[model samples]
Target: MPWKHADMVRWLHPQHLIRSGMDALVASIFGVRADHRLIVAVGRPQPPYFDYSDEAAGEDFWLDYVADTGDGWNSTYAVARLLAKPSLELKDPNGDTHALERGRILVFGGDQVYPGASRDTYEERLAQPYREAMSRSPDPSPHLFAIPGNHDWYDGLAAFMRLFCADRWFAGRRTRQSRSYFALKLPRGWWLVGTDVQLNSDIDVPQLEYFRQTATYMQPGDRIILCNAEPAWIHAATTPHPRGYMENNLEYLQEKVFGRRISLFLAGDLHHYKRHEDAEGRQKITAGGGGAFMHPTHAPRALRLRDGCEQKKCFPDEKTSRELTRQNLMLIRHSPFFGLLTGALYLILALSAYTELGSHGLLNIHEALRQLAASLVNRPMSLVVGAATLGGLVGFADPAFGRWRVPMGLVHGLAHIACAFLVAWGAMYFTVSTLGICAEPPSPKLAAFIIPGANACAGGWTHMWAKFLLGTFLTFAGGFLVGPFVMGLYLTVSLNNFGAHSNEAFISLAIPDWKNFLRLRIDPEGQLTVYPVGLERVPRKWKATHADRYSPAYDPDDPQATDPILIEPPVRVMPREQAP
Candidate 1:
């Protein structure tokens, strides 16, 4: 079965939050980052001995590149199935037909694994899917290389080094690079250099020296395709920390290391496809749509890049991205587990504030309000919880919103707290009025620790216990449904109208649409060609197939599986000397 949403990683879940904090702490204290890179320097694998530089291979050779993958099973498998195929024919909008052969060399741009780069996650999400797909293909094994992204760096790149740097056979692809980053000599005097930026955008000295050595092998008039973890160009323009090391270092590489040699720059931190071109024809492309949740391309809007490149193409476009943002209104459907978190928090807060309800019970609105107000001063812990919830929401607001986040986030948090109050009151009403139990409310002190019961009647204790259980369940269940709806609605409004939280908003939605990858070829004439291919939707239902003798492989259960399409016409780059 395709992995259910329940099995998917829930960012709001407490367990994940705890693990993330621990990983951050470890990265800070242990500082294995330097040691990990040193180990790679020592254990560097041999680069491909043969050059694809001019007639390096037959005329039919091509390569595949994908990034930001290894998350959900079905979605990852969808891209894997396409890549593993021996060949594919997709149509561009102009009715032109483009044929793509399975890449002889598979280059993973960044973040091949999600959450963390543990061997377990890579086996299940990354290796297994590709393995299943390759089993059906008749083609011989290909060469593989990958660079670590932030998620891969979560374990300080230990798992990534172990899996990708070992130079072993994996998923029908031979791991060629000895380190997390690599430099490959491609066909026709063109080189592909991939760098490791790790968690910070700054490249380590040893790794930069490795690339410096790569520059020595480059001859005059040679062109290069540079790949990095994050799109430095985009960050230069879109983020608050613009023009920092991310862009400056890339420029340093171009000016000091490989001047006028870079023909293209490729990256995939943002989970969508965007291509920008300078007037001189040099292109910087962001094609991250490799099976992760769709990020809105409409915001952080950069029509003209830092280097004077204009936007040429974008998959799902800005219009479609805006439309998809509307799905946040249906937030619970996408992130139902978020409700579990809120429900539990609400239950705890209500229990703490039980003393504030007084002898009047919840039936008396005026009296209940007075006690609730009193609890704000008397019960500091409950007030602290409510304040934290409110403050967190404020911080969650986009920093770009300026002071508006204070009001907007406070309103959002207050709305949730108000909902909790209503659930508490309703639950108490049912316990006392509907069930005729808890005629005398229990002490607030005991309620916070245990299920408080009445002691007046012989069986009043039993009656009060039943009332407590029923009230608690009702309050929690009601809060669960109400919580996500509130959160979803707030996220929807902030993102659609204010253009905020593109990454955070969609992760909650987990939309499995707009998945894409890049396929490249070096023609016999020595020109490079790129095809930006994508599918609008992933197959929701898949069936296990023994066909093609690939056991454990799957085909879409949906009778009419969607076909891939070109986001734009094939981009052809001529040799540097031959440029018009």
Candidate 2:
């Protein structure tokens, strides 16, 4: 329980000030020096893009991005192999085979690992896997960069900073950026700006100033590719304008600090892939599908559609998104390990109840069941009536059950809770009446029940009444707390699977086995193309490299794949907004 106590306290720290304090203490003791130097670089050349654009005197560049997908438990080994491979080998939907080349720069979006951001977690989850990938590849390693996500900040960014910022070889690549944020200067007046949102707090003064100085070096017409740690705009529940500090800061950087136009805005906290373009042709893409669990493409909270944006154009169509959502929900239902764990928890709870009551001579299993059944003789009618009434009301309000889901669930859950309390009271009354414990006088004193730690007694009829009242109250209270919790979980799972529609906010699915990433190539003319690669199997080199490590990190005996297949027909990046 003490080990679990830390986790309870840690989650309570939503602002993460406590974690930050711990990080400060850790850094002081370890003599950890934080880095914040910006790195600028020219992009790699791409012949196809250069040939297509034609008038190319400048160089070309490519950057691959993925986020919220660091899963050391599964997929990371295969993902590492894919990254190490020179190019993807795959067949398109038309059965045409092609090799999609790897990007020259590999930029991680964030959330490098699940559970927490500890050094051991990073070593196994990210560093060791990628390091092996680099070693197995014959080609030179691409320049590696990373921005911290909220998960990375869970341990106050200690491991993230060590892996991505400090001047050392991690994952078989030297840390290039001095800070969590950096600016990559591309050929032909293009720039890649990565920012640290600092765990939902405002951008630190140093980071803001660093970007301002970087902006001073740029011209007004420069095409900028913006990258952030979280998708603040899409995550907003009510409206896009209200819950968007990241957007506000980026807007200020574009309009005031730099006076430049943004070509592409990229973020990856949502753990799924999405592309949304405004009327002005500015692209806002969320591509977090790296290797972690998948998320659903739910509808945004606001029902109103934006001007000039159709259903599928703004986001995936409802049918398509729903299918994706279903796939994830089904994955959870069929997960062998998850089901096993749930069963284990129920067993533990049952055992705990039996142990506590058995020790106090309060539990007689056969007698308890017999009394429980007798108590429930007249109970079914009330539950049936309540459920039927609620069901009728729900059906009348919304046949599809979309708009009224939350309110309906809450009301129905409360009814079930009340029923549980009544059942508990009846069962307890039957048990105590049959056992005759209530008939015993308190500590052999006068015919009465005495308070445990008080000089108080209720004699004669009052003693029996007091015992029954206390038993009923305690049982009802326990049942009231537990019944609604179980009912809520069941209803939520049902709605998540069969009901709820998503836009970009209501993510309630885990896309199992479909690991993906994005490769963006900028031509000499400053035009960008995006290739979304999905892994269908593990790579051969991944199986061979550090083969022994697989057992501890991931069981090789498990029925996962050995080679990865890529998703076909990559999406082309539309042209940036024309320079004003």
Candidate 3:
């Protein structure tokens, strides 16, 4: 589709050479200037801390005003949530006011407030601060291309759209409507595609479709900047399951639209800085640390590189000792909550198992412990004991035993119940012990044992203990139930197989000479053979006929490049009849 104005077409179709040429043609036709500077600002503004702070009283007070003064707007694009405090100030480095001339700066990303976009939230957290910052600026007017983040969508973005896009309707129409995604064409050779990546199901549908259509207008050598609230590339890495829309669309853009073009991606949901580069040299920058609650740290696969490395550092914060300390504390606190829940579940399961086994004859708690320990040392031996216990329980409940069987049944049931209870207790014991170990402050001696220059060892040790304990509990429980049943079933099946196969030659043959399952062979006669359940010789044409005069064969492992002509056949193209 052709744009009404030449500048508009250039801004919209930076990737399309034909469209760009048409823009030049239209500009000449309309006689308008097409050159302008473009800049982008993206940020997320919310309270910096997750929880309240008492020790930060003085710091908090200073931050309150610092937030109000709009000091965070150090960059060109004040792309931030208004609630992030300290709105972006458009000013000179020397503290001089600078008027935002037309086509100078653009605010390209983020929601203005967090959570539900209540009118109160907009006024208190966003509108008021934004107004104050604008008034303070020397030149209060600048074109802004703001997009809503998830929080803005909390209340369906009623207040946000009204506040930002009120003046410019969709397609410059007079009718009022709200949109979370839009495309902008700057006066310069720049095209900006802003998308809302809120968790809504519709984000991938309409938004991605629009982005693809918008890219059709772009030309080669023109810069296209894609702005989204969530770093789509990070989601690609972290999401355990595949969503075809995001994966396919991203692949299409990277291969087709962005091929050999200077394209940039901007996003802000992570609340921290992240830069990811792929094998193909594509880059994604996540500048989520605008002013929201910092996300808890987790082990990231990508490592930070040295300053001069070809691979850019993914996370600079992870390398800092202070950041590591904070991360360790967060990890310790997060893991135990799940551990506690699992322990409670196991306890309940243990009680149920105890009830079931108590009706059998095996009710001795002490005996059960002995059997458990013995089972660990010897596998089938434990199975024998477990089967006896089960049979005894069944016998005790049999009518032939009468009154005596009642007591026997009770004993057996109690014994089984005890075993089940013990399983949960054992799991909980280890879980609690590990938590205690982690909870205890590291001693000076223990600290010395840990790696020097590393953060606290408690987090690592706690994680290890939790995994070990959980694994042990699961193994014990699974073996207890399945071991006896599997052993008996296998014996029954084997006996049946033997009886059915009873014949003159009942014995199975064993090939002791054939050590490995399969062996490779090359015959001196130039035939290659494979021997296994059956023997087959390779076709004569497929066999290697020539060998190096100096060596037995071409050794790929040799520390030298192979002769290209020797290894590869020369290509010769002739008339179709002479192709062979």
Task: Indicate whether candidate 1 or candidate 3 has the larger TM-score.
Answer: 1
TM-scores, all candidates, are 0.89, 0.62, 0.37
Candidate 3 on 68-123: residue-level lDDT in tens?
11112111002121212222223222334322111223343574543235566555
How high is the CA lDDT of each candidate model?
Answer: 0.76, 0.52, 0.35
Error of 3 at 49 (Å): 38
**Candidate 1: count of backbone clashes, pairs at least 3 residues apart or interchain:** 5
lDDT of candidate 2 over 307-393, digit per residue (tens): 232222222334555555444323333232333322333322221222112112235555555543443353554445445545643
Candidate 1 TM-score over all chains jointly: 0.89
Candidate 2, which segments miss by more than 4 Å at Cα? 1-60, 91-98, 136-140, 236-248, 258-260, 299-409, 412-511, 536-568, 574-580
Point to the candidate with the largest lDDT.
Answer: 1
Model 1 lDDT tens row, 1-580: 6433223456656676678778767765554435477666766644433365554465855898999888777778889888887788999989999888889888898988766668788887787777777644344568888988878887778888888888787777787777877888887677888888777676767776777878888788778888888988887777666657545555677678877788888999899999998877788999887877778898767789877998888888899988888887777787777778888877886876664232345458887777678866777777888988888888777865555778898998899888888788788777766666756544543433253222332235566667667878988998888888888888778877776777778888777678899999887667888999898888878887776633347888875557789889998764566542
Q: How far is candidate 2 from the true structure (C-alpha RMSD, Å)?
A: 10.9
Candidate 1, residue 115: the lDDT equals 63
